[model samples]
Target: MSSRTQHSIIDLVSLEKEKINRLFSTADQLALNPFIPSKGFGKTGALLFFEASTRTRMSFETACAQIGVHPMLLDGKSGSSLEKGETLEDTVLNVAAMKPAFVVIRSGDDLDFNDITTKLQMPVINAGWGKKGHPTQALLDAYTIRKHLGKIEGQKVLIVGDARHSRVAASHVELAAKLNYEVAFCGPEGFLPERFDVKVFKNFSEGLAWATVAMALRVQLERHVTKYSLANYRKNFGFTVENLKGLSDKALIMHPGPINQGTEMDTEVLQKDSRCRVLDQVSNGVLIRQAILLEVLGGL
Candidate 1:
């Protein structure tokens, strides 16, 4: 293994713009030739997921395999000591005792990593932390925008739908401030956050007309306390092909998935729309995550 100092990726705010750019450049290289020489042979890392996931978990595992690292999957809910009333910090420390190179965590609550990072010798990568942030997802989203549009700065990205309950939207808002882009929110009044500094659009059509990129967010029904009509939501906020006609032909469409098919967007919009970058987001996720692993593991 490389003798470089360890690093943690907890949030986008903790990263410098130059470092972010370097990661993007590394991702670009990996995109061209994914068969880069492995620098993590015989090394191991841990994945601790307290929240349910599909893309983030699998992408991290796949990235580990590509770079020759063994990924140790830890069941945070059922199989681990977490089931036996062990604290999250204690569980992490116990895993650290095994001396893995790093740990990627997707926690159910918004955890402060400062205390945890100070106690560990290895790196800690935040996969997702409640509705606070998903740094890696934001990274890949930005990368996708940059890849397709040739730039990210100054681009007007209108994030539509459940802003109040979306960690993806939260991270994007933070990233927009850091990366010099315009980000706005559009959804039902109750679905939007109570207090945010960015612009909020009441009209989805107007939002589409103004955006250089239209990012649709999944309505987090699971997080909702009071019941609301899915049909009403679809009627008001759904991104159908007809409704999205106000969006420019050159503008890109994005969604951080497990999309609620007809609720968030029409099937045709996700499937037939040539401007949609949902698959590009998924494919870039792997490369961006590979770059992330390389950075934290000191392989780059």
Candidate 2:
């Protein structure tokens, strides 16, 4: 019923508990030696990103190259056929005809990949889908947290900021639930999700006290329909220098970048805070993606 058992990862909820652990194991091994000896010598992967990206796109391309898989990247903005008003299906058909081993796609329309399994001949990994989810990001995030905290289960993770529109937040909430990790949300009232069941905190101090991992999400300004005030958000909900200094010794600071520097967190927190693992998250992204590509392309 869910895409979890399928070759592509469209939803983290579809991933069984055992699969998550296995993936983490594979990622751990891959992280130790990211530049591998060509597990996918003859394979090719097509990466179609319809939205703006820096980390996901580069990390996926790097993963393909390092794993010995040729990566064919398509940016939807430029000379791509989508500019000529070509249907997404037609574009996908053209790409599929090239006979790639798999496809990693991120579309602005969150529902574009709903029927992806039947539309393409090869496996399709949902790189990202609008407000719905970013399964790969969530997977890498889980792997990163496991690496830092020694385990995922039973860990209290406080996901703060713009939770309503953040696909990363959506993915992590689901993934954490599946892995037995406790998750909570903290954000401005309008920015929080209505369907999430976890405890919602109005105070950052309370959130920090309740969490071992404090994951600050970027404000989705691109998706917000109303005017957002950075100054107001920072004063009420952001991770300030004061907050960082007061954090528990065992607490770890995390953020899914590109950070709003002074908005979601003070710039100094990134520089002086020793517990921030934003860069580690970036590094783990490539390894987790490599593991995903290998899993689909028959090279592990």
Residues 192-295, model 1: lDDT tens digits = 88757889999998898999999999888777888679898887778887788899999999998989998888999999999999989999999999998888
- Residue-level lDDT of model 2, residues 124-202, one tens digit each, is 8888898899999988888888888898888888999988888888898889879988888998888889877778988
List lDDT for all candidates, in order: 0.87, 0.83
| Candidate 2 lDDT score at position 221 | 80
Highest-scoring model, TM-score: 1
Alpha-carbon error at 135 in model 1, in Å? 0.7
Poorly placed runs, candidate 2 (over 4 Å): 1-5
**Residue 257 lDDT, candidate 2, scale 0-100:** 90
Local error of candidate 2 at residue 106 (angstroms)? 0.5
The reply for model 1, stretches above 4 Å from the true place, is 1-6
Question: What lDDT does model 1 reach?
Answer: 0.87
- Indicate the residue-level lDDT of 101 in model 1: 86
**RMSD (CA, angstroms), candidate 2:** 2.0
